[model samples]
Target: MKLDDIKPDIVHDVTGTYCPVPIAETAKQIKEMEIGQILELIADDPGVVEDIPAWCSSTGQEFLGMYEEDGEYHLFVKKVKELT
Candidate 1:
């Protein structure tokens, strides 16, 4: 299935937040989710456009894709690692 076709299990809006906040919140949220669960992170921080994907790569999560709407970014991420 396409990345956008996947339904998110959680939607996080970190619009006004910057830098580490978006990534930090995403990390916190994904930890509570089961493997294979999806998270839709909505943010306006330009750093997240690169940070989210890089964080996912480093953490072994799946960075499905992202889209922009009304100057906001929607990042699709999937939980691939189990929290130990």
Candidate 2:
């Protein structure tokens, strides 16, 4: 499926937040999501460019993809594993 065509189950916007904040919020948000649900994180922090994929990798979740739009980053993540 095209990244632009993806419909997220949840959308969290952390526009003015910086590094760690974006990641931290993402973790917290993902924890409440059911497996197979998609999360669309909108942030202005460039840190998410690296943080999101890395977080998903270490946590065993799925990093679908990401794209930048109008100075903001749009990250797509899928909950593939249940948080313990």
Candidate 3:
């Protein structure tokens, strides 16, 4: 099913490069979603291994899980609270 099928709280296109900019954009999108909703992040950047989880923990968002599909990384994070 499409990631959107999850009807995620938000979607972030972290594809291309896993630099700070895309990751930041992902965070921005996630922050814009509703609380307790899920955000699906599409990334291929290796830095996401550190960036994704770090951002989740640092901000108290719930890092539900992630998986690799084709050549991309699909990560899902639940917004447990609003960003400051």
Instruction: Give the best candidate by lDDT.
Output: 2
Question: How many clashing residue pairs appear in each of the predictions shown?
Answer: 0, 0, 0
List the candidates ranked by TM-score, beginning with the highest.
Answer: 2, 1, 3
Better of 1 and 3 by TM-score: 1
lDDT of 1 by residue, 1-84 (tens): 686588999999999999889988999999999999999999999899899999999899999999899999999999999644
The local lDDT score (0 to 100) that residue 62 gets in candidate 1 is: 94
lDDT scores in order: 0.92, 0.95, 0.79
lDDT of 3 at 74: 82
Tens-digit lDDT track of model 2 for 49-73: 9999999999999999999999999
Error of 1 at 71 (Å): 0.6
Clashing pairs in 2: none
Off by over 4 Å in 2: none
Off by over 4 Å in 3: 1-7
Displacement of residue 58 (Cα, Å) in model 1 is 0.3
Model 1 scores a TM of 0.94
Instruction: Say which prediction, candidate 2 or candidate 3, comes out ahead on TM-score.
Output: 2
Score every model by TM-score. 0.94, 0.95, 0.82
| Tens-digit per-residue lDDT, 1-84, candidate 3 | 444456665767758864887668867887688887888888888678678888899988987777788878888888888889
Score residue 64 of candidate 2 by CA lDDT.
Answer: 93
